[model samples]
Target: MSSIDPMWRLTCVYGELRTENRQRMWNTIVDLKNRSNLPWLVVGHFNEVLWQHEHMSETKRPEPQIRVFRDTLESCGLVDLGFTGVPFTFNNNQSGRKNVRVRLDKAVAIDSWRDLFAETEIKHLTTPCSDHSPIGLTLIKETSQPTVRKVRHYEIVWEKAPELEEIIANTWASLEHNGDLASKFYQQKLEDMSRDYFKDLFAADPNITPDEIVDLFETKVTNMMNEQLCAEFSDNEIADTLF
Candidate 1:
């Protein structure tokens, strides 16, 4: 395979329903991987889950099953492609609390495949026809130039400093004059101020005491502690934890 393109060894799996047979099948797959160091992907129903979170309600998830499934993957050096779209890929479709939901199906690939296809994306689409959801595996081709996404950043230390708030407010006011984006404005100011302040703080006189450190934080930070910790946390995480 060229540096621009990698090879594919797509192995479709439909693990046996029986425990003993499933173990044998898992061993066989492990053996295949051991023999070939090629970049490969395994997509299908594995009849098992590696974590309790993979199954909703947790009524049917036993420790032994999860243990064995994890062991098999560890031995084979295989991992889930970190799917998007859905938490669980398999559902019984039963209504009420009696319904069962588990991630029985997924696309797992070797570490080399991940390294080769850094832009690979696996999405678990809505389940149709059968209980299992159809998974889409995409390998993004090397483009003329990679798309650099806009990154939003906030400093954890700034949340405790009010100076950060002043910098933001002033930068935001300046944005009206410059007609620049909020993200760009914030990042630029933060990067500049953070470097200057931290460098000076570190270059302080040797006679500086612990109390002076707190004093420096107060002067430089600007009481940004009021920014609300919720702003730093994700909406889902805030809802789950706070509410």
Candidate 2:
């Protein structure tokens, strides 16, 4: 009944708890598969496992039930995108042998979808509030553009210092301008200049004491509160703020 440009489809499912009732969900997916040949992704809690290893608990899952789910995926041409991080997504939160965990949540994509998103990665992220872990999907598209190299430059207070020009002249004059050695010498001079500048800039002020700095901060805070925070509000202002 609807169409998306570039012909891609996504279906999100929250399956029935009852195995018998889940047949309707599978039937609906199969019906949708017949309608389009677009890149398709089906994701969510299916309430079913495709393999015995997908379920871990005291009681084993019935093979027939898992087989039905596997058969459904095969019929739809949907393959599990696999995942990173914890193997299981659902936890029963019970202690010891009473505990149960299963990979109930997942993302499955058709071959067409795989071709478009060849660099897809699915991550299983756990949350404290929910028993079920959320999954993160990343799709990276291939690009023809070349990666640009990044160059890092340090911002220094050299312009503020009057002796900067003399330092630059002496450093530049001392460098060996033969080839690569000249480049290395220049870099060393730049590092030395930045280090000396920072040392001078952050050197403690002998004129001011720590007590003076603390008093200044306290005075500023008190003045700010008196000018702004301590100001009385009008009845309309209070009403507006409360509202």
The lDDT leader among the candidates is 2
Q: Backbone collision count in every prediction?
A: 7, 0
lDDT of 2: 0.83
The residue pairs that clash in candidate 2, if any, are none
For each candidate, what TM-score against the reference?
0.54, 0.56
Q: For residues 80-192, what per-residue lDDT tens digits would candidate 2 score against the true structure?
A: 99999899999999865678999998899999999878899899986767799989888874568767865546544556667667766765677635457666666666677
lDDT (C-alpha, whole model) for all candidates: 0.76, 0.83
lDDT of 1 by residue, 171-206 (tens): 878777565587677888788876766776657577
Q: Against the correct fold, how does model 1 do in TM-score? A: 0.54
Error of 2 at 129 (Å): 0.7
